[model samples]
Target: MNLFERLSGVIKEELTSLVNQSIRQEDTPEEEIERTISQMRSKVMATRIAIVRSSASQARLLKKGLVILEEELAQAEAKREALLRRISQANQRLERATRPTQTPFYKLEEKALELEAIAQAADELNWTKKINS
Candidate 1:
């Protein structure tokens, strides 16, 4: 596998780990949360770098980018869950912890859920079109 593909796998694993870590904790350390968010930020950097590296339409290059993106999506799926967990955890911990009362990206969470719904609808539409054709 190429650099992008490897990076993508790393990012996905990191994200998955972050989700697992966050979920397993009765109380998470600030440092761990920061590390998780930092890794995600790095994943964004890796994605942008991969996109910039999009120079040719060679099968390998194309595949490399796609794998990275797939990893990113998997990571995002984990993130979506983890974010919800964070929000829930924050709410539960609100009276005791110094953390904020709500998750920072409530609107973003809603939007992501909306996008997933749209994607599912599009898939159904495409399947219907194929059957009709």
Candidate 2:
């Protein structure tokens, strides 16, 4: 072979070797980047799942609290109704007790006069008996 052809062949071989080495170096970093991205995606998915579970647990607790409050409200309403009924009954009794009687003033005066006359007659009879004995 001529000197020029041999030199060209050697140059081509060196360039090919440099290209292959650079490609290998680039491939390793690309694969590492892909693995890091996959790890980040998995971590994000796990965080989202935890948030969803926490939200669900809080919702259940809130629902239970609401139910308890509703029951308490119902009981309070019942107690208030009973108190109102008792107040109504007390008011009725007070009205009846305070109402005026049907008896007239002239009838009471006549009863007093009759009682006084009976007392006077009994005293006179006892005095007469004592004097005779």
Candidate 3:
């Protein structure tokens, strides 16, 4: 009876150990699944953060580029205006250079009368009498 009691005690201990090991095995898969889910959540959060930061950086760069484009547009407008003014000035100079110089009719008539009076005075002078003699 003593030997039988010892054998029964050993068998009971072995069954208990196997039951505990099976429970641990079952709980291990659940723990590993939970850990995997947590790691995935962390990766998703990190990706979202990176995307947000990249978007902000891209926005800043685009804003800077817009500013530069506006400045260039302003400069281009100023240069265009300056070129137009210069072209207008050059056209005015060209028109003036190509214009014909015209003397007034009144000035020509006055000069003709003055020449006739000088000729008449020269004919009455003794200088013409000596030349004719």
lDDT of 3 by residue, 1-133 (tens): 2334533654675577557666774565446545444444443443344344445665455455445545655565566567668989999999999875556886788789999999989878968799899
lDDT per model vs. reference: 0.69, 0.60, 0.59
Off by more than 4 A, model 3: 1-55, 105-133
* lDDT per residue (tens digit) for residues 1-133 in model 1: 5666766787688878768876874655545655655665666566566556655554456566667766776686587678879988888887567644466597678779999999999999999999999
The most accurate candidate by lDDT is 1
lDDT-based ranking: 1, 2, 3
Pitting candidate 1 against candidate 2, the one with the higher TM-score is 2
Candidate 2, residue 44: CA error in Å? 36
Q: In model 2, where do residues sit more than 4 Å from their true spots?
A: 1-54, 103-133
All candidates in order of TM-score, best leading: 2, 3, 1
Candidate 2, residues 46-115, lDDT tens digits: the string is: 3344344445665455455445545655565566567668989999999999976657786787788999
lDDT of 1 at 109: 83
